[model samples]
Target: MDDPTPEVADQEAPSSGIAKAQPEVGPPLVEMVNVWKRFGQGAGETVALAGVDLAIQPGEFVTLIGPSGCGKSTLFNMIAGLTDTDSDGSVVFKNKPQRDGELLGKVSFMPQKDLLFAWRTVLDNATLALEIEGVPRAKARARAEAMFPEFGLAGFEKHYPHQLSGGMRQRVALMRTFLFERELMLLDEPFGALDALTRAMMQRWLLEIWEKHRRTVLFITHDIDEAIFLGDKVVVMTARPGRIKTVETIDLPRPRGAEVITSPEFIEIKRRLLGIVEEESLKSFASAGAS
Candidate 1:
């Protein structure tokens, strides 16, 4: 397996900054065209994904929901250029050579674990990416410092990872990812570690942040409720050797609140997504039992 590409570390790099004259809205930001990923060699090979074709429009929040081993991470790795597809059946992102850094700082990814540094203060950890890029320490710290307050991490800047609660730690981790200044974000179970109440609060907090920022986001999770709650569209995948199952647009109104989850429209959408997920889950269970 080839190593993943290095992430771009520029904290203050001039953004792509499209001009108003161009109207700035054309093609989708990322396109995965007939992508397939298989792991290992010969009989031991695991076919993780197959024939995936999807386009994520700018500022769209898309979610992927499926049982474990459904190739969710495999798909993510392809998008991040962390893994390669066969030259024939490949994934194309940002309309450039998939191997290039064209999409590097333009996209940010937050993994399942918070992965915060134990030794560093929250502000230091958040600015580490910028520090690595050779941004002056003072400048990086200043940029990162302001975000702690914006991310609801105001009082914790001086604290370490061990000093924060689970949800607070996750917030810091997320701010760190955001400081990379990407136009897109890929999140994998970002709130899974939190308690139910904290998860609900974080969900609401995330929506508020997303509304203000308007970046394209592709989020992966096993939680059906979360998928429906956070996504503008939910894209389902098959059990193994995952393929596009369905893409359901969430018709709920923007700036959705907790009450929206109880509305008839929201319930209906959740019911439909749950039905599809249930069907796929059964197939996955059966396949595992047979093996």
Candidate 2:
């Protein structure tokens, strides 16, 4: 396969990249056009994301995957309204432009590390978002308490972060995100730190919950299998100064189990995604060598 031409890591880069799985129908819940992010200028400048366009329908599960330093997390930040896009770019949410500062608290975000507080009990940690929204501690705890059974933390509400296993901590973090109650959820490799078996279990459990709630989710991962398993559409991104390289819709039947990974269709999608990712990864390494 021919190597992908780099996006030049700057504002002068190409305007459009790949936008696969373009909505089957209906308006998108989130849309980003010509987005760019640069840190510093002159010799010390670093371009994180180049011009890119992407859209996700309401309640859709979109998984973003790319090689390291490709700005996968940077893209997530822009969507969560935690970071800003450059001038002339747009981050539109629910039909309104989000460049001015509207996205701040409109979405819920879960980063790689759970960042749970040690002193706080699981209940306190899970209810933190509610507490921030001015809900009384009693009310916040009450609401979170009700969902513990579903979250698998039913009897562990009084347990501290340090007392919980790695997977458990992640579950609490997700519950906190869910309690925030927004239409969009950005999860940045929430399962990246766990053991292989634990990670697999978390993936299955997450799908079940997502099916029940039907909330829109944007997940980031370097693991292609995880990305395909969790997302309705798997979005492949380019090297540093990230941009979409392809957007493939996951056609696998839902309520999926680990056996799904062995299916011929699943294998085919993985093969294609791996080819694109390998090409970009090599390009990134070559650039590093030349630098």
Candidate 3:
């Protein structure tokens, strides 16, 4: 497999002292062209996504946010090859069109829940995907054990999910995803269930891990602040029959500290994103009330 790290060109920083990722030279790692998805038929028919066009460059941390029921998970399913797009559109992976289930195993996916097995030890759980790939259990365990310290699970190798705190459980889940070793990772609200402080710490830890690995990431989150904090670009979707409402490039410097959130540029971007998200949320609420 080719290296996923992007080659960024040097550019002058913006007046706000924020630097942005310039356009890369190669084809996008994944591209969705005018994608659409629908369910049922006639009066019962519902459109989940409509004419959605998105492209993810290699080694980019792209965060997606939208109103509830805006088809975020559905979009993720398509990208992960769990489902097919409508006939009228195309989902291109590595510049090739992908059919139903074709992208499976091509991307590592972690949904909202940790989904750790209570019966297995932390090391065993982290090695599950590798073991399923037909790797010898011994070899898989060896590899997983080596990552324990990096994931902050050292000395807890023999512990089960029930024995760990919520944050620790999430780290284990993430370790499993990373160990699977895919070019792209689809993370859907992995930190949503954590408390405020834990979530903040996890966000920082995740960035550190991401910087080390440089895997292409597509993260879905409801928190606008989280999206801006962790993304190279923040993609905002509209209400039901979801489509890309806007894609805001995050210009804040990386290795970002918590103090950066209160920076002028961060606040400015948040204000803009908040307005767009709030407008979509209102529309979603109005539609729900009518239904």
**Candidate that would win on lDDT:** 3
Candidate that beats the other on lDDT, 2 or 3, i.e. the better one: 3
* Every candidate's CA RMSD: 9.6, 4.4, 7.5
Q: What lDDT does each candidate get?
A: 0.78, 0.88, 0.89
Residues forming the 10-long window of minimal summed lDDT in candidate 2: 1-10
Name the lDDT value of residue 260 in candidate 2. Answer: 96
Model 3 local distance difference test score? 0.89
**Residue 218, model 1, lDDT:** 94
Of 1 and 3, the candidate ranking higher by TM-score: 3
Candidate 2 lDDT score relative to the true structure: 0.88
| lDDT-best of 1 and 2 | 2
Instruction: Identify the candidate with maximal TM-score.
Output: 2
Clashing pairs in 2: none
Give candidate 1 regions above 4 Å deviation: 1-25, 100-106
- Writing each residue's lDDT as its tens digit, candidate 3 over 9-79 gives 22352222122333456899999877888898777889898777788999999999999999999999999
Identify the superior model by TM-score, candidate 2 or candidate 3. Answer: 2
Model 3 residue 95 lDDT score: 89
